[model samples]
Structure formats: C-alpha cells, structure tokens
Target chain A: MKVAILGMGSVGKGVASVLSSKDLGVMVTGVADSRSGLIDPDGINIGALLATKRSTGLCGSAGITAMDVVRGAPYDILIEVTPTDAVSGEPALTHIRTALTMGRHVVTSNKGPIVHALHALRSLAASKGTSIRYEATVAGAIPIMHTLADGLAGNEVLALYGVLNGTCNYILTRMAAEGLTYEQALLEAREMGYAEADPTYDVKGIDAAIKLVILANTIWGTSSCLKDVEVRGIDLVTLDALQLAEDQGCTIRLIAEADPSNRILRVSPRILRSRHPLVTEGTLNAITLVTDLAGEITLMGKGAGSVETASAIIGDLLAIRSRYGRCD
Target chain B: MKLEMRDAPGQLVAALKPISDLGGNIIAVIHQRDPGSRSEVLGVQIVLDLPQDRLSDLTDLIRSQGVNILRVNEERLLCTRAVIMIGHLIHTDLGGTVDAIDRTGFAEVTGLTIRMPAIDQRSSARFTIRSVNREHMEDAIAILRTVAREKGLLMIEPMGVSQ
Candidate 1:
C-alpha cells in the first residue's frame, strides 16, 4: 500500500524505520515534519529521508509543506502522527478530514482529533466509504481499539476500567516504592524523561481524561468529549497517602473508567489492592474489558515509546491492508 | 447429521457407506457405543461435505438402512445478542430455558452469568444467544420471551440498537 506519514517525530521516525526494515507490503510515499515535508508519487526513499532528518534536522527542503503532502501526494492511506493540540485538534483533524474526503483510508496516533471530533470524522469517513484507525492513541501499543472492535466482535462490552496514563502511573509508583515526596518523585520522573517539563496535562488528569473520552467514543459509539469526563489527576496524591494505603495492602492508581449503560466517565486516583489487575508500576498500562461473553478480559503492555508506538501503527497498517488489498 | 444405529459388527461401517456412495466426503465420524443401555444403540454423528443435489438421496439411503436421524443442521450461527433475565431464575429451571434456545437449530445460548443474593429471593442472569442472522435472532428472542412468560420471569433487552 502507498502511504504518506505526517509528523517526523519519534513515533513517525519509528514507523518509517519499521516500514523500511520489514516487508509489510507498504511503501512510504511521503513524510513531513512541522515545517516541511517530502513527497514522491513513486514512494520516497525511507533510508535517505531518515539520513536527511538526522543531518539537517528536517524531513524536507524549501517549497514543500505538510499541506502539499496531504493534498497532492499520491497515496492510499494517510498516517497522521502529528503532535496533539488538545484544545484545537487542529492540523491533524483537518489533514484527516481532507484525506477522507479524497477517498483515502487514515491511520493515526494523535488523540486530540479523535477525542474532539470522533463522531464528525467517523461520519465523514463512513459517507466517503473509507476507514480511520488509531490503535496507538489511548495507550501506546496496547491494541485496545482492535481488541474491542474486532477481537471481541460478538461480545457486548459492559464496562471498561484501565490505567491509561504512564506519566502519572510512574510518578505514583515512585512515590510509593521509595517513600519519596510528591515533588521529589515528580523531579525524578522528569529526570527519567517520564514526565514532561510542563506536566500539567498528565498530573492534573487531563491526559487520562482525554484517553477515557476516546475509549468511550470508540467502544460505545458515544459522542463524548473531554469536558464530559469528571477529571481528577494525581496532583494531590501524597507519599503519606501511599504509605497509608500500603499499610492497608493497597496502592494508589490513576484509574479511568467508562460505564456506557449509565453514561458515566471519570478519571481519578483510586486506592487499589496490591493484587488488583489495574495496579502496575512504572510506565506500564493495563485495561480490563468486562464483556458479556468474554467475561473480564485484562490486557497489559508498554504504554509508550517510539518503537512500541510504531508497533501499533504497523498493526493498523496491516489491518487496513488485510481489509483492502495492497494498492496497485 | 447425527444418528443412532443398533450396536453390532459392521453397524458403524453400515451407517457411513450411504454417505460415501452418494458422493459425500466424510469430514468427521464420532461413534460411541453404550453397552449398558437396554437398547444397545450406538450414537454416531457425522460431518459431510456433500453436494446440494445429493442430500435427499443420501438421507433416503440412510433411512433405508433403518438408522434413526436425530438432527440435520445446515446453517451456522453468525450473529450474537445478549439479554438479561430476572426473577427466580434457578427456581424457574434456568437449564431448561437454555436448552429450549439451544435446541432451536438456528440459535444457541453461548454465555451465561447468574447473580443471586439470597436463596428464596429473585435472581438475575445475563445470557448471550448467537444465531444465523437477524431473523433468527428475532426468533430466538421470541422463544426466550415465550419461555420467560411461561416461567413467570422477565427479560431485559440490551440498551444499544443492533449494529
């Protein structure tokens, strides 16, 4: 399949490298960074593109922009990996819309577009007779969307509960394991590259809330936005509270839950037992899908990283190829 | 098809010769003989890949051998639906209710979960039924409704519309 990648970040670079290394029957026709893009109808040289990015810090030269790749590039699937703008859901949203309007399938890892405009974009893709897959959006490399949409096809999902955000989970784990203060744990997390310099979204629960909204929309076909969630992050979770919970054979975890029957969605730091399925340390994520036929099925895996996220992107690409044959 | 034949030498071979003579490729043959039963009949179930035109001839040949045909299933269940039933499930014979759906040939109960708080109080169960298509699903629901009414139970349909 001829594919175009928009966003030459870690995830994008990882996807390009995987496509180059593996014979997944896919060709990278175009690639873009924030400022520039590279497009060739006959499939761009992935090795040369990576070398160019490494040497000059950009994927394309002058006169080539992301808009050009979206509109003019000859490809069947558009892979949108742009940085998320939670408030606007911009550039990524528009790029996806344009690609679907032009009758092309879309695979994305960006959460903003899906969280904000999932219903609208899904309707557009359906009307256009295409598909949009974002397996890496919620929990990186988890394949939760595929599990719900395809793996459990005949089963009805009654509820979903998960530990989706890695940054907060890392901070909480550190504070509990080391008996360190919240500030010290956050500092250690930043030093370890787990927490961003500006960790407002992760610490204040906005990130997990966004993920919950995406899960709700995908699983239940609900048009739930970020504002609909009752958000409560790990900002106030203290070492004292952790110790207290530990004393009670429990640990604190930022849990995101969605109950479609009651239309309830929330993310909060809850006290979980030591043996609970959702309790995991470090940058790991776990989700339990309570379904009618499958009972409670729990899946756990790495939630983020360049190579891991690329694994999910490649999975989406293969799923598309299996559904629709490789582009001629 | 499933069948029963008299337990004797060559009885098992006799049950399958008709299918082969009618140009059917045998996929599987399950033969179990119960010597303890008074009738001494052996249970035999066979799966065959036979042409559509020869099905009648094959059945005629099998019946001519005095073999009793138990079931003739031609369609496979492809769609699924889940419903909740409440009100004294165990007391009303939940197993019989499940058996009624499973015997429909087009629908079968695939999953079941029961919740009971007390011995004599009302109980609830969530059961999933898979069928061949939408029409079969409706028929299954109608059967469940009839069973529920006869047993003084209530059926709670799923909230989301069928996709």
Candidate 2:
C-alpha cells in the first residue's frame, strides 16, 4: 500500500518512522507540508527523512509539498497532519474535506477535523466509498475508538465517559496526592512536556470534546456536532475545592461524556470518590463505557506522546492493509 | 401558584388536574421526590409552551389551589466562550486559577484542564466558560490573568491573539 503523508510534524514523522521500521508491505510515496517535500512513487527513504529531521527541524518536515513531482502519481492514502485551531478547528476541516472529496482514505491525528466535521466528513467518505480511520486522535496511543467501534460493536452503549485529557488528569492527580494547588500542578506539567507551549485545548476541555465527538459519532451513528456538547473546563477548580473533595474521599477529574437523549454531551470536572478508576494518577487515561450487554467496561493507559500515538496510527494502517490489502 | 394541600399520595395529580381542566399545561412541578426528602423545598427546572397571554391565567388558576411556585426562571442553554490560561496552571495554583475565573458573576468557568508529564514539571491550563454575555467572558478572562500574574505565572490566551 502506498501512503502519502500531508505534514511532517511530530505525529507525521512518528507515522513514517513506524512504517519504515516494521518493513511492512506499506511504503510512503509522497510527503507534503508547508515547506517543500519529496515524492517518490517507488517508495521514499523513511530512514533518510528521520536523519534529516534529527539534524535540522526543517528536513523531512512533510512527505509532500505544494509542488508536485514530475510523474504526478497519486497515493492511495492521504494522511492529513495539519495544525489544529484550538478554538474553531477550521483549516484542518478544509484539508480533510478536500482529501475525502478527492476520494482518498484519510487517517489523521488532528482532532480539529474529526471533531468539527465528523458528519460531513463521514458522509463524504461514504459517498466516495472510503474510510477515515483516526485511532490516534483520542487517547493518543490507546485504541479507544476501535474498542468502541469494533470490540464493543456487539453491544448497545448506554453511556460513554472518561478522563480523556492527560494534561488535566495529571494536574488533578498531582493535586490529589501532594495537595499541590492548580498552579503548582500546571507548572510541573509544563516542564514535563505533556502540554503545548499554548495548552488551551487540553486545559479547557476542548481536547476532550474532540475525542467525545469521535466516540459519540461512532457509537450513535449520528452526527455529533461539536457545538452540541456541554463543556466545562477545570479552570474553576480551586485548592479549596480539591481539599473539599479530598476531605470527602474524592478527587476532581476532567470528564467527557456522550448522552444520546436530549442531544446531550458533557465535558467538565466532577468530584469522583475512591473506587472510581478515573481518580488515579499521572498521564493515565481511563474510559468507562456503559453498555446493555457488557455493563461497564473500562480501559486505561498512556494517553499522549509521539511514539505511542504514531504506533496507533500505524496499527490502524496495518488493520486496513490486512483487511483490504492492495484494494484499499 | 400556592396549593397548601396535605402532602399525600396523588395529591399532586389531584391539584394538577384543575390546571388541565382549565386548559393549562403544567410548565414545571417543583416537589421533593420526598417532600420530606429535603426539607419540603422541591425544585424543578421547566419550560412552558404557552403564549404570554395564557400564562397569567394559568398561574392564577393554579395558585387558587394553593400550589406554591417558589420561583420561576427561564430555562435556556448558556453561551460558552473559549479561554486560554497560561502559568503554572497545573502546579502552582490550578484550582485558584479556576476559582478566580469562576467567582466572576458574569461568567462561570465551565471547564478547566492542565497538561504535563510529571508533577514537578511546569504546565498550563485552558479554560472554557459559559457566560450570559461577551463582556462577562472578557471579565472572567481578566480575573484569571490577574490571579495568574499574582502567582508569578504566565498568562497566555490560546486564541492565538496577543493580549
């Protein structure tokens, strides 16, 4: 299978590196980014790209560029890795829509497109007889989407909720354990590289909203628009609130949920007592899904990072390849 | 409406039947699942699908039976605003940061989150608020920024707009 990478950002590079390391039948054909990219239909050198990027942040940035190669050959899969707008999540929406319209299967880690344009994008994919697999969008490395879409495919989901944002969970967990105030926890989190230079989406619950939309759309088979979700950030949590919750044997966690009835979607920080796995610590993500047949099933693991998320995207690619092979 | 009838079985139904008899739809019923459940103050959030002209008569008719309408408030979904807060949002004072914004009457911090790898590491938080108006939203952000500065934390607004 020939794959075309849209951006050579952190996640994109991780995808390319994983594909190259496994020596799977998959080959990267074209790479594109804001900067110029190289395209070799015969298969580009993934190792060479990594080396260039390691030396200088610029080289191997994207697998393809605005400029096309002399041959003008198209790729089977177009991975869109554009930057996400934390607020409206726009341009990413435009890029993914265009790619799907062009009849290319898209796999992205960009939450902007998946969260805001789920209905339109899925409809376009169906119209074009292609799929948009985004395993790495939420829970970074964990296959939360696949768990709901495939593993629990046999059950009717009653309620789906979780601590989807690693950043928030980390801050809360720290506050719970060390009695650190929110500011102290945040300072610690920034030094650890779990947050962006500007960590708006992760902190405000917008990041969790993106993941929630993906789950709601996959489970309900309805368009879960971003605007519909009831969102609450942890910004209101105070040392007193944390102390109060702790005194009651509870801790605060930024949670996201999808409720089909009343068109309700909730994302906020709520106090959880002991025995709730969500109250646990540091960069860990846990999801609880209430189903008619399965009851409540919970899974937890590393929620972010390059290698972990990249591995997820690659795993998704392998699943596609395994099922459809050259046909896909 | 104030209905001072004995809190008995189906008393609500008996009281409500009069409203229906007069072609009045019960917009809300504020009764304790246990009238003794939480001190006789049963609160229900509701909306009526009646024209303003009929509302007065409906209230008058129900009040004649002694059913108390403690307080009637409009039920509407609040507007939400996105805010990016920077500082030791995760470490130094995340809860305080949220509190500063939440305390602002015009806006309430509906969402607050921080990200980082370790507790010892520094991090920032993004805040989402629901307010009645745009000015309320700005005021809330200003409060957060002020608190952040006091804590010796950097305040970054993630909208990508320089503050």
Candidate 3:
C-alpha cells in the first residue's frame, strides 16, 4: 500500500523508519514537514529522506506544501501524524477532509481532528466509500480503539477510566515515590524530556480531556467535546495530599473518565488504591473499560513516544489494507 | 413514623422529643405546612433509626405525649464513600461544608480527619460520607462537588471499578 505521510515530526519519522526497515508491504509515496513537501509517483526513498531530514530538516522543496501532497499526491492513504492543535483541528482537518472527499483512506495519529470533527469526518469517509481509521489518536500503542471497535464489539460499555497523560503521570509518580514537591517533580520531568517547555496542555488535564472526548465519541457516539469534560489538573496536587493518600495504602493519579449513563465526563486527579489497575507508574498509560458482558477490561502500554505512536498508525494502515485489499 | 397532632403550638415539638429521649438518630423530618388552611390536625412523617429493642418503647413514649401514630416506615443507610478534600478548610467554613450534606438528612459526614501542614499552606481532610443508598450517595456527591467548587477546594473522590 502506498501512503503520503504529513508533518515529518517524530511520529512521521518513526513511521518512515519502520516502513523502510521492514518488509511490511507498505510504501511511502509522499512526505512533508512543516516547511517542505516531497512527492514521487514511483514511491519516495524513505531511508534517504529520513537521513536528509536528520541533517537538513527539509524533506522536499519549500515551493511544494502539505496540501500539495494531500491533494495532488498519487497515493492510496494519507497518513496524518501532525502535532495536535487541540482547538481548531486545523490544517490537519483540511488535509483529512480533502483526502476523504477524494475517496482515499486516512490513518491519523492526530487527536485534534478526531476530537473536534469526528462525526463529520466519518460521514465524509462513508459518503466517499473509504475508511478513516484513527487507532493512534488515543492511548499510544495501546490498541484501545481497535479493541473497542472489534474485540468488544457486542458488549455494552458502562464506564471508562484512564490515565491518559504521560507527563502528569510521570510528575505524579516522581512526587509520590521520592516525596518531591510538584515543582520539583515537574522540573525533573522537563529535564528528562517527558514534559514540554509549556507543559500546561498536559499538566492542566487538557490533553487527557481531548483523549477522553475521542474515546467517548468513538465508543458511544456521545458527541462530546473538550469543554464537556469537567477538567481539573494535577497542578494543585501537593506532597501532603500524597502522604495522606499513602497513609491509607492509596495513591493519586490524573484520571480521565466517562460514565455516559451517569452523565459524567470528567478529567481530574483522583485517589485510587495502590493496587488498582489504573495506578500505572511513570509515563505509562492505562485504561479500564467497564463492560456488561466482559465485566471489566484493562489495557496498559506506552502512552506517547515516536515509535510507540507509529505502531498505532502502522496498525491502522494494515487494518485498512486487509479490509480493502492492497493499494498498488 | 407518621404522626397526627393538633395544629396547636409545641405539639410537633412534643411529638419529636421522644425520639431524642429514646436515643434514636433522626434522619429526616418531612412535613408540609399550609397556613391558609384552617385544619384542626397536622400530619408529619419522621424517618429515624434506633435499636430494634427500643422501637416499642419509643412508640409508646410518642403516644404518651398525645400524638397519634399514623404510619411507620423504616430505612437504613447502606453506602459509605470517603473523599479527600484539599484547600483552606477553616477559611471556607468547614462546618458549613459538612452541614450542606448533613442538612439533607439522607446523608451525613460520619467521619473526618484533617491534616494541617502549616498555618497558611493548604489543609487536607478525608470525609467519610454515608447515605441511605447508592442513589442518595450520588446526590450527596453532587452536592459536595458544588460545595467544593464554591469553596475553591480540590475534592479527590474515590474511583470505583465501575465508576
């Protein structure tokens, strides 16, 4: 299958590297970074492009653009691994819509478009007789979307709880294990490259809220958005509070939850028993879905990373290929 | 127990004094008043819990006060959930915060433990809220959520397996 990948960022590079290294029956025909774009009808040399990007950070000419690849490329799938806008769902939204309208499959690791324009995008894909698969939009490498869509297809979902933000989890874990203050733990996380320079999105619970909205909409078509979640951050979590929780054999974690029947969509720091499945340590994500037939299902894996997120995009691409047959 | 009494002053009070006298915990006292009506009798329903052996004695004592017993209903609190609240407890009127739930009568904060780290730093408290059942517990939690928002407190609620 041929794919045109956008955003040449960590995730894009990871996907390119994997496709080049393995015989996955996948080819990269077009690639783009924020500044440049590449297109070749005979499939691009992903290994050479990755090396060039490592050295010069431009995949193609500045004259060409991501939209050029999205609209003009001769590819079977548009792989969108762009950085999330969280609000506008912007350029990614346009790219996704244009591809779906042209009857091409879309596999994205972008959360913004999925959270904001999920239903509209799905309608476009259905109308065009193509699939828009976003397995990489939620928990990284966890296969959560696939599990909900296929594995637990017949079960009724009662509720969901997840530790969705790795930065917050890392900071909270450091604070609990070492008794570090919030500031100290956050500083450590930043130094370790787990947190961004502006950690507000992850620390303030917005990132998790976005993921929760995607999960809720995908599972139950709840039509929820970011604002619908009653969000509370880990900024106020104190050492004393952690100690207090420790006194009772419990710990604190930032949990994104959705209990639609009870009308609850909240992302907040919650107290959980230490032995609970959702109480995963340091930069890992865990989700527990309460189902009627299965009772409760818990899945845990790396929440964010270059290669980890690439696994999800690759999985979606493979799923699309298997269902619709290979793209020449 | 439902009681019928004269609309005369102090008759309602006279009817309720026995539950306290017999060491019963009054849960709810539901009554309706219509001053525009000139009815001679007032009906009141009281929900309370007490030792099983003390039930007959409490009923006898209420009747002795000239309050006619109409109907009796019994219910027990069946759920308890503990939540941790972190904020300036004293500044927010902790008593009032607790009273908000207790005032509902169907739920109460049965236990509380506070840890004050310093004079100005935030304090943390764990409140064990008990309710008649899961439904009432949810309502009590909603009330506490509102109270937490009003008082600038971060309430960390328990996360059950099924939410």
List A-chain TM-scores for all predictions.
0.98, 0.91, 0.99
* Clash count of each predicted structure: 0, 57, 0
Which pairs of residues collide in candidate 1? none
lDDT of 1 by residue, B1-163 (tens): 8998887788777779998888777878987666677777778999776766788888888888888888887645657776666678898888999999999987899988776757976665667789866777878887897897799775544322221
* Candidate 2 docking band: incorrect
Sort all candidates by TM-score, best to worst: 3, 1, 2
lDDT (C-alpha) at residue B150 in model 1: 94
Model 1 spans > 4 angstroms off: B1-163
- Model 1 interface CAPRI class: incorrect
- CA-lDDT, candidates in order: 0.84, 0.69, 0.90
DockQ of each: 0.01, 0.03, 0.42
* Candidate number with the higher TM-score (1 or 2): 1
lDDT of 2 by residue, A122-192 (tens): 88999998878888888878788778778988899877778899999888878878888878888899999
Tens-digit lDDT track of model 2 for B13-126: 655765566664466664435534544433333344443356667666656766666554442224565544444555565777777766766567776665553566555454
Q: In lDDT terms, which candidate is top? A: 3
- Please report how far candidate 2 places residue B68 from its true position, in Å: 43
The residue ranges of model 3 lying beyond 4 angstroms of the native Cα positions read B1-78
Off by over 4 Å in 2: A60-73, A86-90, B1-163
